[model samples]
Target: MNKPEKIVAEDLSEAVTYPPEAFISREYAEAEPDKLWSKVWQQAGRVEELKAVGDYITYNICHDSILIVRDTPETLKAYHNVCTHRGRRLVGNNTGGGPKTVAQDKGAHSARGSQMKFGCNYHAWTFDLAGDAIYIPDKEDWQGALDNVCTSLTPVQVDTWGGWIWINMDLDAGPLREWLEPVASLIDPFEFEKMRYRFRYWGIFDCNWKVALEAFLEPYHVQGTHPQLIKYGDFYSFSKAFGFHGQTGFDSKAHRDAGTAVETSVHRAAGDGDPRTTIAQMQAEYWETIGASTSETLVKTAQRLPLELPEGTPAGEVHQYWMKIAKEADAARGVTWPDLSDAQVAAAGLALSIFPNVNFIPGPTFSLAYRVRPWGTDPDKCIFEAVALDRFGEGEEPETEWTFVEQDLDKWPYVIAQDISNMVEMQRGYKSRGFKGNLPNPWQERKVTNLHRGLAHFMGTGHLKRID
Candidate 1:
C-alpha cells in the first residue's frame, strides 16, 4: 500500500471532493476485498458471545466467510469457514439473504453452534474446534492421497480488544492494538470490556457502506438534517485527523473561533438560556430519539434536576451535580464506573471513525457503536449494524441477541431513522448530473476526507478525484 498524501483542513477547497463514483461505482466496490478488507483488522463479534469452549461465530465480508471459535478456555481460533472437500460453507451458506437463500439454508443445512467438532455432513469429514482435521470419512481408500495433505483449516490472525473479537485475513498484519492507535488510547479509559450489550440493531440499507458511516461522522448536519435537535443545544462541530483515524465532536464557539485545541465531547450542551435545563432536555431527547448514547439513569436524573436544585444554578454546578447523583445511583446498583480523568473523557469525544468501517461514541458507563459492511459486491447496498453497550452490575447483565429489523424508517429509533433517510437520498443523488461531488466541511468533516484518503492509500491510488 502506498502512503496517502496528507490533505489537512487547510488544503481543502470545494474542489477537494469525493466523486459520486467513490460511493456508487461497481468497479470500486469490487476491489474492496483485496485493497481494504484483507488489509485491515475487522471486528467479528463480542467476547461475551463466546464464553464457552466450542462456541463460534461466522463473519462475512464481501464473498469471504471467517469462522471464529473458542477452542479452549483460554484459546480462540479463526479459519476459512469453508469445507476443503467441495468448498461448501461449514456453517449455513451466508448468501447475503433472500427468501430463496433462507429456504436453502434451513434445517440440516443451516447452523451456528457450540460443538466439540464441526462435522461436515458432506461425506462426514469432521474437524475439532482447534481447526485440526481429527476425522475423515474414508481412512484406507485414499491413504496416500490423504497422508501428505495438511488438513488443518486455513488460519487467520485473531485477537481481542474492547471485548470485541477482531480477525485479520492478512496473516502478517500488525497487531490490533497498534492498528487501533491513539483512537484506542483515547477511548480505553471508558473500560468497554466491562460493559454488556444493551441492544443490537441491523438492517439492509440502500446506500454504500461508507455513506451510512459518514452520516454519523460529524454533527455538521444537525441543523439541516435534525433541526428539531438544535433547540436543545448548539451542534457546531470541530473535526480533526488522528493519523490513520479521525474524530468529530461538538465544540464551543469560543474554542472554534480562538483556534484552540478542541475538547468538548462529554461537555454539557449550553445555549443562551439556562444551560442546566438545556442539557437536561438534551439528555431526555437523546433517550427518546436514539434510545442509546446516554444512560437511562442519567436521563432520569436530568429529568428530576429542576426539582433537585434551585433555579439559576451555575452550569458547572448543574453538570457536577447531575454527574454526582447519577454516579451515586449507579454505585448503589453496583454498576462500577471507570475512573476516567476529565481530559481523557473529553478527548474520547462524540465519536471516532475507525479506518475502513467502524464508528463509536464512548461514555463513562454507556456507549453506542456502528459497523458497516458491503452486501456482496454491490456499491448501492450494504448491511448496517448498531450496538448499545452499558455498564451493569456483576451477573446482572441482561441477555441480548442480535436482532434484525426491516428497513422501514419506523422500525428504527427516530434519530437513526432520520439518518437512514439521508443515506437513501444521498445514494440516489449520486445519479444527478448537476451535482459534481461532496463539498465537505473541512473543519467539521475532516474525518470524511481522512477516511477517503485511507481508502485511496490502501487501494494504491492517488485521490479518487481531481478538480482539473
Candidate 2:
C-alpha cells in the first residue's frame, strides 16, 4: 500500500531566526488577506474618532475596505465600503497632504463623513449609517432583482474594546474580548478607553506589514538601533505569549524573584543604586525622543526627584515617591488616573501586540499605539502608522485628525525616525544572498515568533528538505 509522506515545519522563528521569505515573497503576501487579516479582529479607529452620531471612518486592509460609523451615542456599525449598485468604493483613503521635513502641530481628517447617510461618489447610491440601502436612483427600473442582491452594504462584525473600534470579517470568529484574553486582562487596569489620540501619522513603507510591525514587538534591538538611548539605564526586556497575542516587558526584580512574565517599563522605572538623578534623566529622555510613554505630569514629577529624595534613595522607594507625586499632580489637574493595583503598576510593558498587527505601549497617563497594513499585494510595501494617546481632564482632550506624511523620515520624532530609517534597508537586506534570516533573541523575541506561529495555524506550515 502506498502512503503519503507527512510534511513538517521548519519554523526559523522557533529557532530564534525568522524565515526571510515571508518578508520577500509575493505568494506569502498575497495569502495573508485570507489566511490572516480577514480571520482576525483588527483595530479601525478610536471610539473618540466617531464622537458625533453620524461621524464615520474608513479602514482599509489588503483589498477590503470597511466603513465604521457611530450610529448613535451607544451604537457603532461596520459594513463593506463598496457601493452595492456598481461596487465602487463608497469612501476614499484620504491620507494626503502633510509636512515633509518635520511633523506638524496638528493632524488633518482621514476619509470621513458626517452626514446622516453616505452617498457613493460614483453613482450616488446612498446608504444610512446603519448601512441600510436607503435610496436607489432608478429603483423602479431594477424591479425585484435588487431583492436577491444585498442592496444594503454587507454587514461586517464590529466591536469596541479599550476605546478602539475593531472589525472582523469572519462571522464565525469569537468576540473581540474573547480573543483578547490575558493580554487584555493584564492591560485592562490601565484603562485605555480613557485615553484619546494626541498624535497621528501614517505613511507607506517599502517593507512587509509584518516587518514593520516586528520592529515594535520587542525591545531587543535597542542596543544596535538606538545606541544613543543606552545612556538611559537598560532597555532590558523579554517577551511572553498570551495565546495569540504577545507582550514584551522590561527586566524587573519581581520577574527575577518569581521567574515569570514581566512587562516593559513605559514609565522608564528607576534603576539600581541612587535613584534621584537617574529616574529624572530617563523621564526627560523619553519626553525629548518619543514624547508619549511618560505623561507630562510624570515627567514634571520626575524632575522633582532630586529635591524630593535624598542622594542615596533606594530605587524602589524612589518609584513610590515619584508615582505619589505624579498622581497628586494629575489629580490637581482633574485628571483621573486609572485605578491600577500595585502589582499591575509594577509589571506592565512599554510594548504589547494584539495578534496580527496592533501594538501598544501602555502607561499611566499617556501611551503610544501602532498599526501596520499591507499597501497592496506587494511583498515590499506596507502602510505604517503611529499614534500618541493621553488621558486628560473632562474637556482637555485635543482635537486630532489623521495625518499622512511622505517618505522623508526626518519628520518623525527622533527615536521613531531612527526606527523607520532601518525598515527600507532591512527589507532590501533580506533579499540579498549574503544575508541570512533574522536571528531573534530567544526569550526576548518570543513575541515576534508568535506572529509566525499564528500565521502557520491558518496557512498550514510545511518545511523544505535540508541539504546533505
Candidate 3:
C-alpha cells in the first residue's frame, strides 16, 4: 500500500564496491555457510508441494539439508534432514508425500493417506513427523544416552508467507516477514499463493553462485546478452533497491512508447499486417530456434495486444486497454484476476532480486523464479534452480518435478542460455591477470551493487573500497 524507499542512481553511486575475489575465492565460499546462509532465512519450497498432512520436501543449502513437512492441516514444521545416529540423509528424494521411508527404492512413493515417520536406512533409527525420536535400534547399548539428549531432529526455525516455505538455521533469526520487509508487503497483493508450479529445472553452473545470481539482477545486460529482446521492447530499465531486495523493469507506458518504432520486435502500426500474426511467428521462432520455453498465458497475453490503437492514444490508455482484454481472457478461463493498480499492472514483466540468492521475473499470469547457491566449497561451481509458476484455471492439474538439464549453453532456453554464456565467460574474466574488480553503471546496475552491499554487510566485511 505504501511506496517503499527508493534507491536511485545517485544512491547507487554512493554505495560500496565489491572485489573480484568475493566471487573467485574458495575461502569466501566456505565462509558463506556460517556467515550468510545460516543466519538468513531462505525459501525452501512452495506450500503447494506439501499441501497434504504427510507431504514433505527437502531443501539443501551448502552443507545443510532441511526437511520441511506439513505437520497438520494448518501447521508446517522443519527439521535437520540428518539421522540422529549416523547423519544419513532422512529424505534422499527432493520431495515426496506421506511418511518418510527407509527403503532405498521408495524414492518416488507418494504420501497420500500414509502416516508420517522417517527411518534412517543405514540404521533402523526412526523419528515421527514432529521430529520426536520414537525408536532407536539397540537402545540398551547406549545406556540411556538418548534419554538426556534432545534427540528430535534438530529443529530449524520455519515459517510460511506468500505460499512459500522458508527456513532459518539460526534459531534466533528474525521472522520471515521481518527479514523480507517491504518486499513481502509490496508483493502480497499479487496473491502468489494462488499460483501453482508449472515446472522446475536445475543445473550445475560452472561459476560461482554470486556470478550466476548477479546475472539476473538487472536488465542492463539484456541488450548485449539477450539481443533478440531488443526487437520486442526497450532494454532501458528503472531500478529500485530497498535494503536487501530490489527490482528493475521498464514501466508499461515507457515500454509501450519505446516499442512504437518498427524496429521494436513486437510493436507495429495498424497497417503492418495482423499483430497476432507477427506475434505468433515470433513466438514460434523463439521456441524453436532460440530454445526458450513459452507459456500459454504469455502467448495469449501477447497475442491479444491491440496493434492499432487510436492515433495519439496515451501509453497509459493503451496499457489499460490491454489489461481490460487480459482480465476478460482470465475470466473466460475461470481464473480470478487480482485487482491491481496502474503501477502494479505496469510492473507485470518486472524482474526482482531478493538478497542472498533468489531472483524472479514476474508476470501477471506467470513468473519464472530462480535460486542459486554455492555447491559445497567449490568457488567455480554452483547449483542453479529455476521454477516456473503460473495461475491456472480451476481443476487444472500441473506436474511438478525437477528437470535436470545439461549445463551447456545450447541446452538452456534462449533467454537463460544467453545469461549463462556470459556467466561462464565472466568467471574466466575474473580470474584474468589484467582484471581488477566490478565497476557497474550506477543507474543500470544498481541492483547488483545493492546485492553486493547486502552480501558485504552479511559477511561483516564492511563496504568494499573502490579499486580506482
CA lDDT, every model vs. true structure = 0.79, 0.76, 0.69
RMSD of each: 3.1, 4.8, 6.3
| Poorest stretch of ten by lDDT in candidate 2 | 97-106
Q: Residue 29's C-alpha lDDT in candidate 3?
A: 75
Better of 1 and 2 by TM-score: 1
Runs in model 1 deviating more than 4 A are 1-15, 93-111, 147-149, 254-263, 461-468
User: How far does residue 149 in candidate 3 sit from its true spot (Å)?
Assistant: 4.3
lDDT of 2 by residue, 341-457 (tens): 667755565577898888988887777899988876778888899899999899999997777766577788788887888898989888999986566665678788777667667
Model 2 RMSD in Å is: 4.8
Best-matching candidate per lDDT: 1
lDDT of 1 at 142: 72
Descending-TM-score candidate ranking? 1, 2, 3
Estimated TM-score per prediction?
A: 0.92, 0.89, 0.84
True lDDT of residue 128, candidate 3: 90
Clashes of each: 0, 6, 4
Which pairs in model 2 have colliding backbones?
Answer: 249-263, 249-264, 250-263, 250-264, 264-349, 264-350
